[model samples]
Target: MSSTKDIDALIDLMAKLPGLGPRSARRAVLHLIRKRSLLLIPLADTLQAVAETARECLNCGNVGTTDICDICTSEKRANGELCVVEDVADLWAMERSGVFKGRYHVLGGTLSALDAVGPQELRIPRLLDRVPSEGITEVILALNATIDGQTTAHYIADNLEGQVRLTSLAQGVPIGGELDYLDDGTITAAMRARKSF
Candidate 1:
């Protein structure tokens, strides 16, 4: 029977977001309440808009406001090279470095036997479909370095074998590292030193 039940609910919802815990969510909610006009209102509006309009890109599995993401529709990005990642966060990390010039294919997640996630569960079939249609010459597997990530990468490489040149980011990356967690410089170096797998 807290007087601030609505605010507490807001904190609970925010805490569910990745990287934000209960303490952080409470602080954030308090800050938003204090700055309602400057931050809270705007954030609420934007969240509402995104909730209504955000969707997966039909072509590349990217999260966007349209059926096809901007990268997939951009002619300049169609360079015969496709970088495959486990999530949209990894794709955004790669884009942050401004190193990759080609298009991207987001696998949504890695194959996990324990989780029972297979190629069909993810966007693998769509990836295979895109390769031939888009005239892709190379596919760079930019997945994380975990066991599940490696397993997924091997699967994709096997499926795409003989169709295009397959490569992976170089090994300056630590074991179990996720692309989204790597610094921009590290991502740049790894991408630059990518080799055939």
Candidate 2:
């Protein structure tokens, strides 16, 4: 083992985090060491607190410091609109956007035949239960545009047909995006989802 074994191990662990490469992890570790009193110690304490208290919301599958997340418990969020997402990260992204006022249901993952992930593995059954139990009038399928995501959406739609108003997030060119810069798939989706203006 090297003299900096512990530091090397920290860098390796940090590199395992999403979007962080070996060089980035090394740089981050160095910065944290340089700013230990101001940043690293506080970050470590916060991480410990989160690790100790963070858990999944019982009703909606959102990760929070409580058994039920704030959104699920909020009366204002009882808007009869439930947005279905594939993961807690998707739920967080939607929250950050500050657009949707409805509650959310996290499916954990999509149905993947190769991965052997089915509806039971996800929160599909719980979602179905929530529609009637929570008096949900509409369900927005906010799954990703991948094949498995679409397949999961279709499955849920088929199951919930006639029970609630079904909708999905429109896919197309992003805001301020030029048509020339968009990929073929994005342009095609935009055309398909076009509306009369």
Candidate 3:
């Protein structure tokens, strides 16, 4: 048996992560090996802990170590508004901006016709239920600028019309751009300038 077999397997697994290729994974693994006591050991412990505990919030679909995420459970965030986003990453991006005071609803993904994804596939039904249960006065659609994202937003708007005020992030969100790529200032500006959908 080769002594480097386990290390090679680790590198292979790391390469599968987003934004990391084989070369980068190899370099990272080597660096981690050099800093084993400081970085690698702690990182391994954290990864194991997270792997065992990470779960999606039952209320809003945001990922956390609990049944409900911190944002969903916060009384301060229940400000009569709910921001709808396509993914957990988008929700995290919005939170990082520290601008939106209200709560959030993560849709998981856009409505994809080709992939046969529909409202039922996402958290649309749960979002609709939350509107009435939570007394949400406004819903800010912060979905991506992609075609599927807009389609999903429009569908939600149609379902929610007359029930509450519906709005979307302003035009500064470039076509095909995901919320995760935008700067915090741009996100804040788009949210502040949101218009009726």
Candidate 4:
């Protein structure tokens, strides 16, 4: 057996992670090995724990350690507003802003025709269900500024017309920009200046 088999496997797995390449993974593995007690062991434990327990929230599609996420279960978050996002990362971005005091609806992805992704493929139906059930008075579309994102937002707006107030993040968000890339300040500003869709 190869003496470096396990190390090679670890590097391979790390390389598969987003934003990580084989070169970076090798460096990271070396660093982790050097700091085993301080970082590696703790990171490994946390990864294992999260891998086993992390799941998408049934109500809003947020990732957490429970079937229902903390935001969905919290009474304080039920402030009659629902912020809709194209992905869990976007939801997390909004949370990092610490400006919105409402719950969130993660759509999982945007509606795409090329990939054959539709509203049914996303959590659009569930979002519709949550509108009245959760007493959501406003739905802030915090999706990215891409064509697919805008298309999905418009579709949602059309579907939920007159049921509740509809708004979208302000125009400062660059075209094709995803929420995850925006700074907390920009997110807060966009949320604050949201206008009717």
Candidate 5:
């Protein structure tokens, strides 16, 4: 039996993760093996714990360890503003900037005609429900600038025309860009300069 078989399998698995190719995965696996006690074991333990406890927030679709995420329950975040994002990664990006104090609504994904995705496939219904129930006075569309993202934003805007104030992030977020790839400064600028939809 090959002694390197398990290591090769580990590299293969890691390579499947985003941004990690075979070469990068091999290097990472080697580093982890070298730091087994300090990094590898702890990482494995955390991954297991997260895998078992991770769940989508019942009210906002944010990923967390409980049914309701901390942001949803925080009275401090009850600022009558709701930020809608296409994914949890976008939510995290907004949070990293610390510019938006309002609650978030993750749509899971954008509307895609090619992929047969629509409002029903996302969390649009829940978003509409939250607007009235949570007393949201404003909604900030923080979705990506991709065609699908723009399409999804328009749909949400049309459905919520007369309910509340609607706004979208301004400059800095390039066309066809994603929130996850933007820097904190760009996110802050875009948020601070948001405009009406």
Candidate 6:
């Protein structure tokens, strides 16, 4: 007997998404309903399709509709370098930068003692296996600038020390950052990694 019951339920469900709160979700649902023919129906169909097919790539842990992602199967990406990221979102970020030409390896998460997450829980073992098999020459750690991220990076570095060259993204001031706004840790890293002009 409630005409707005299904709409309210839809708003409730949309509000559960990462960044959307109840207000945003209600606005979004209203927009979708207004554009039902052009957006809502197609969006529903696409969501259903993705829900049925989306899966993690077996080799690199990238999310895709196939067992392996397109990047893993691309011949042009066979440059002997592998960028290690903490999640699929990081992998996508690196790709968006368009600077890293080599492939990527996604560790499901960082190694956390409190969470009981270890190398095995991530893609560390798979990464080690891929080094020799895939002829990897260098590994670039592109993890976050967090304590757990550094710990995971160090663990990977220790394991792959002599087997391949190891590198990490520089942790310093952003390109447009002013020194006064930067933290002490960022300033120190920028000083330590200072290069010739």
lDDT of model 1 at position 165: 97
Q: Kindly report which residue stretches of model 3 are placed more than 4 angstroms away from their true locations once superposed.
A: 1-3, 173-197
lDDT of 5 by residue, 69-188 (tens): 999999999999999999999999999989999999999999998999988999999999999999999999998977899899999999999999999987677778899999887888
lDDT per residue, candidate 1, 1-197, as tens digits? 25387987898899999999999998898899999999999999999999999999999988999999999999999999999999999999999999999999999999999999999999999999999999999999999978999999999999999999999987656679998899987788778877899
Point out the higher-scoring one by TM-score: 1 or 3: 3
Q: TM-score for every candidate vs. truth?
A: 0.84, 0.93, 0.86, 0.86, 0.84, 0.94
Stronger candidate by TM-score (2 vs 3): 2
RMSD of every candidate to native, in Å, equals 5.8, 1.6, 5.9, 6.0, 6.1, 1.6
Best by TM-score: 6
- Model 6, CA-based lDDT: 0.95
Model 6 lDDT tens row, 163-183? 999999977779999999999
Question: After superposing candidate 5, which stretches have Cα over 4 Å from the reference?
Answer: 172-197
After superposing candidate 6, which stretches have Cα over 4 Å from the reference? 1-5
Top-down TM-score ranking: 6, 2, 4, 3, 1, 5
The predicted structure with the larger lDDT, 2 or 6, is 2
Off by over 4 Å in 4: 1-3, 173-197
lDDT of 4 by residue, 1-197 (tens): 24298899999999999999999999899999999999999999999999999999999999999999999999999999999998888888899989999999999999999999988999999999999998899999998978899999999999999999999977656669899999887788778877899
Candidate 2 TM-score, C-alpha based:
0.93
- After best superposition, candidate 3 residue 9: deviation in angstroms? 1.2
**Model 3 residue-pair collision total:** 0
Task: Indicate which candidate wins on lDDT.
Answer: 2
* Clashing pairs counted in every model: 0, 0, 0, 0, 0, 0
